[model samples]
Target: MKNRFRLNLFRFVLLLFVCVSCSQEYDKALEDALNLAGENRPELEKVLRHYHGDTLKLEAAKFLIRNMPGHYSFADTTEVKPYYDEVDSVLTTMKGCNVWTIRDSLVKIDNKYADLSPEWVEDIQIIKADFLIQNIDSAFVQWKKGAWARHLDFEQFCEYLLPYKAEELQPLDAWRTYLREFHPDHLDELRYCDQLKNSSLQSAITLNDNLWYYMRPEITEASQVRPIYRLSTRLRMPFGICADFTNMAISVFRSQGIPVALDFTPQWAFRSLGHTWNVVLVNNGKNVPFSGATSNPGQPHKPDERMAKVFRITYAVNPDLKRLSEIEAFVPSAFRYPFFKDVTEEYMDCEDVEIEVGDSLDGRYVYLTVFDNTEWKPVDFALIKGSKVVFRKVGMNSVYLPVCYEAGGQMKAIGHPFLHTYDKEVRPFIPDTSRRVTLRLLRKYPVLRHVQGVVMRLDSGEFHASNDARFREYEMLYRVTDCSVTGREVVLPDTLGAFRYWRYYQPKNGSYCNIADIRFYERATGKQCVGKIIGTDGCWEGNPGHTKDKAFDGDLLTFFDAPVSSGAWTGMDFGKPVDIGRFVFTGRGDGNSIDIGDWYELLYWKEGGWHSAGKRKAETVYLLYEDMPRGALYWLRDLSKGKEERIFSYEDGKQVWW
Candidate 1:
């Protein structure tokens, strides 16, 4: 009995010591924040005193205050508010207008505010006590009452639910209350859904389905405009870019007590521009990604899409990032902010890459970069240790370059470009100049599966001619057997009879008679034939520009996309029966293919940048580059025209797209 009593007493003393230590740490952090608050210290103290009676609320208040020094908002909203107001007005009044017209209007508005500069004010200095109290109370109410939020612990709640704003520079307001009350009717069915009651993912999917009906994503020139900082203004707008939709979704989900976050890739491994989306935290501690108003959770990305690294935006400052900023004088823009956490391993398999840097160039850090069409963009960074640098959790099956940033943000290559193969092998592109090989390139960019599908649709299409306007009686003048990237020409037989009407009838297997330019020639004259455009009453998506006449409009970039997938055809009416000798047709495509008359430049990766192999004018469907460096990453650029090109490697006499 005596031993038991002593053991209990010792346990109690230890527990009390731990609790007191934790409290002192919290108080120290709060003191630091108050010292930095300057004139706003009293407002923060008011919040602390108001929540003193409730232990949980007091802890929550401390969490917000401790991290408030780094959080800031735009100091001046005069120029920005009017911009969002005008955008909201335009989106409201021009609802259902042509997408292009609305985009043009938004672009003009964006330009008007392009010169506006941003000035920032820290949240700790300007935030009010009443606003913080209300925000805390509302957050606690939702966390305790919301069924989908039961799985989240106190840390998750603080990170995802308690934050007042989704991003920096956002206008602070009563967004939680407004969003919670705005669409009470939309989620009524979800409340009654027994299977979805406790499932955060399902609830998020159901809410997204309802929200998508009213909101949409539009990639417009206005996307380049200064961000709309007001959540209410964003809600009022009909459409927005990926980041806009993501921030809006985060507001909505958190308002309903669902733990959500924003995830993004700084740059795609295989293409230009980055992408952002929303993710819901579930019971298993896994995040499921879904595009707001676009796709459901677990939907696979497009086949061509690849991610070299993914990061999750967080409300708290990352300690590692803060350390990096302190040690390095200049950090790349991608890592300049301390509000992101790397979550690449959660999305795909990753590998740790260690490269030897013979010369560090007097730099302390090196970055792993991926090609972004026009240039190599840094996706992840590492510290230079001794003669080597180690990049952790890198995505596989992509090409990467190691570079060091010099003064004024200039990147200097420190290591050779290498491919991290899917089988977990690293192969450097050393450029074996001792041997040379010839390359026959088909296109600047790889023909993706979808593009190939469009090309294959031209097969089996039949050309018919008849006197009847309805083509009730017709003769099959010619049949298309194959099509190429440039196009195909079919020579009609000499015995073919003339007809007043001629049309290229689409095959049932074809995808909506998707044809670009088509031309017909008169027999024995070698002269192009012209007539009234006929067939296909409506175009896809009701776009007037894609009407049937576009097939004969002599523009390869535009095509006649039929509203229906079958029985759609476009052709010319001769107005009189005239013998047709041949016809030329091109398929709808991305126009990255080598054109017969276009000029192209072939380059290879060497040392730190691209070195020109040669330039040639394509005389055929493909370009031929002779005596090129073997075992090197190649890029074929269409100097004549194009904006889409990718880096590729030649293996076994074929171009392997990275």
Candidate 2:
């Protein structure tokens, strides 16, 4: 009896210790939040007291209050509301119109309101008790009643479904209720189909496919204005960029009890800009990635797409990033917020990269940067330990540079740029001055194999001339047997007679008459001949700018696209017989090829940054750079015009793209 009494006393003491520790922790956190609330402290206190009767709800309220210090919304709604209103008005008026036609008006609207700046207010200072309560109750209903969300624990529920706003600058409104009923029939098919009712992935796929019918992805000048504040405004617009689409998906999915999060790469490993997409958490704890309104779940990215690092956005602060702040280290704007977690291993095979700085420790933080078009941008950060810094779980097969930020945030290179090769080897581009090689560059960017197949459609195409507009009786002018990136000019036979009507007929298996420019030359004066544009009546999607006249518009970037897949033709009519000396035609292309008479500059990467080899004017289809440095990363810039360029390494007389 004495021993039993002693055991009971010990259990009581342990329970008392745990309760006291939890209370102290909660009290400290609440004090810090209330101190930051200032004049809004009473609103927070009201939320806490309202949930005092329910232990679980009280903990939930505390969770939100503790994390509220860094959350914010737009303070000056009056200044920014007009921009959203104007954009929505324009989009509503132009409904069902082609995206190209709506682009100009959107650009004008964005430029008109470019000077408006909205102030930010912290959630701790501006959030109201009623608003917080509504969000919490709505989130709890979905979590308790949602069939697809049964696998989520309390922590996962708080991070993925409980957040009031998906992104910063969002207005504090009742978005959950509005979005829950936004698409009444989006999941009707899923409910009727027995195979899909039990699977969350299939339900997500069905919903995304249905959303694609109403909304599509479009990149325009106005894409810079993202994270549209009003949910109704975003729903009214039919087109949006990747980030806008992802935000919309988050709002819709989370409201219906599907756990979703946004994952992104700061910059693509092989391309110019970054990409954002939605990831739905499944019962197996795996994230299924899909473009919100453009692609379905389980659909893979294009083969050319590459990622060097992927991050998942979270509402909870990252402990690792918070530690960086504790040490007073400089953090880049890409990682300034503590709401992201590195998730590279979930997407691809990755390994830890330990870069040796060789005694040059400029600061406590070292960064890994990727070349983004015109400059090198930091994508990942690590701390210096002695002379080396180790970055964990870095994706492979990309070029990276190690650098440290000095005072004023100027980046200073600490080592030469190196390639994280696919074979898991670090090959640094240390220029060997003793060795040199001549580079014969054909294009600024690598031609994708699929796009090259589109260029090959011109083969076997026939050019004919006839007095009959129907071309029933015609004489063959020329038959193209091969195609080139820079196009070709073929001299017509002198014996060939002139005709009133001339046209190029697409082959049966060819793409929809995808020709960029076509010109006829006079035999007598050798001058270019002009005629009235005539051909297909409608373009792809009835776009005005993609009609038959685009072939004669003198813009290589513009091309004629036919509504029909085959037998569509674009040519000119002289109204009378006229002799043609030569024919020149260019196939539809991305305009990244070397053009005659355009200036270009070749650059190589050294210890510091890109150094120009020399500028030269292209006299032929390709540029020739003599005595260039061997074993280094190279970049070709079009000095005349163009925006798409990529880095490459010359090997075996050909450019190997990253």
Candidate 3:
């Protein structure tokens, strides 16, 4: 009987647990699931039946594979991404089947409820490609039939695909010759380059059979001579605009005289969003964009202005990984990316400048910019003798390029306007067992009142951007830890007694946007204090698009600084040097009454509770208190156990009066 009673209690507890785990009662579970099944689901049985016949598929695959690479259909209208809507429709209908096929090739497809990459792709995007007649004779063209390829005739299709007409291809190369300003043919006003712009070296090189070809340029020289049109209200370059600007320029190029192509990339924006851009071969010259066609506020970029960098991309070496670092070169000229330092040749030490084999990157393409060695501008071509790549003879300011491994590690290069973009990426150097790292100031700091910069060396192990695998970008996340000699440490989360942390932005007169972020991490414990700036939805503050003194332009966020004192603990902060060489002032997003000039005292572990460590006396000043509890901004007033005046202060163990 007693055992039966115990079993009854166990069953009751089990039932209670199940009740807590779900929002709905168990009685309604079956009904809800049945309702979900009856929702809007398209009939897919017929679609499955269509593909069941094996003999029918083999015949189709043979024909599709034989003609898939060169098959294409162009749209009658000129809505830039002209194929998006139609492609989306095809994608939606195929949502019923998880697998789709064309001849011998089959792509694993998702349901219509998910996002999909554009279906019909014409990889030969350089120049202008329109399908007047459907033909199977090129690479990157999708195989299309039915009403798709019936629009344009073959002749008109070829003409539209050709981009520039015969009449508009004049007065080119002025930019190419200008890239090689010392070539004796350098025109006085604007620059020009004939061979590099119009002839063989143009990015529109041949690929596949005669009709199949692709160019890497999105903006070439001949196109820049014409008027440039833009529609962004703000002058800053944004992460979203990179690809749009590239494509827009390509469209404009084709309209005038030059032909262009888009370059796909997988790099993140300052806000950590993945992005892309375009590179054009206008006329015969290059047009590198500071900002793309779209508007990306909070980014330091200028789409209309010609960026100093005519071309920038990644490269490979011997198509292998053996001697990838063997090739070394840098910005051929000027203030390219901000805080930039083309450290390629800088880290050189004879043997290090050697490439063995097996190094490559997709972004590792080349650009042929105009050069003026005398004026210290651009050159069409630079030379390389064995391990040394030199600007020899009088040539255009351009050359075949290689990948950049700044700070002595491999990294994907992104846009920046400083001399340093070619060098290795820069980040904080962490210290192994790093007990006393120092905070050094930069050449110039932001003008905001409480803003500061910190360089932390991680302890527990030596810190080098080289060894750390997680160091993806050129910035570090950090949070000052308030721990002790074992027992228990006091942590100043993003919030500490109403004082929040702050972010430092770009210095005045910067040539490019300086986008770098420093965050705190506890190597010992993988707990992130969290994105204080990220929480407030703060903007990535810095110099954007060559414009100066603008803050919170990209995205808006809120950060806090150091403490704002306790009701009673000013004494603990003084005369205490217990070894805190590394510290961070965190910002919080919670609470109020956080007076503008209020300060906080440093606290450390003592006994069981936290006591003032950075103060002189125990009762006078409190090193730390409470701020933002959960997501709500709290105060030392909240940290206190009792009322405002006679509140709780950590004195002698228990919560007692000060």
Among these predicted structures, which one has the highest lDDT?
1
Q: Which stretches of candidate 3 lie over 4 Å from their true place?
A: 1-241, 256-258, 261-658
- Model 2 per-residue lDDT tens digits across residues 1-658: 9999999999999999999998998789778989999999999999999999988777788888987888888886788888889988888899888886776787788889878777898989999999998888878877777656767788888878888888877778888888877664656556667666546677677677767777765744236454566888886666667888887888888877778899989988877778889998877778899877788778885435778889999887786787766664456778778888999999888889988886657347788989887777888888888888998888898999888776567888888888887788888988777899999887787666656877876767778899999888999888877765555667788899788888888876647888887878899996778998888789988888888888887666788888888888988899899989877777778777676568999999887878999999965556889898899889999999988888898999987876
How accurate locally is residue 580 in candidate 1, as Cα lDDT from 0 to 100?
Answer: 86
Off by over 4 Å in 2: 1-30, 98-103, 106-112, 186-198, 216-227, 302-304, 325-330, 448-450, 460-508, 511-586
lDDT score at residue 532, model 1, on the 0-100 scale: 95
Candidate 2 clashing pairs, residues 3+ apart or interchain: none
Local error of candidate 2 at residue 341 (angstroms) = 0.7
Each prediction's TM-score versus the true structure? 0.83, 0.81, 0.24
Better of 2 and 3 by lDDT: 2
Worst 10 residues of 3 by lDDT: 565-574
Clashes of 1: 0
The local lDDT score (0 to 100) that residue 139 gets in candidate 1 is 88
Q: Which one wins on TM-score? A: 1
lDDT of 1 by residue, 384-473 (tens): 777878899999999999988865788888878899988888889989999999998877787766677678667777788899999889
User: In model 2, what is the error at residue 308, expressed in angstroms?
Assistant: 0.8
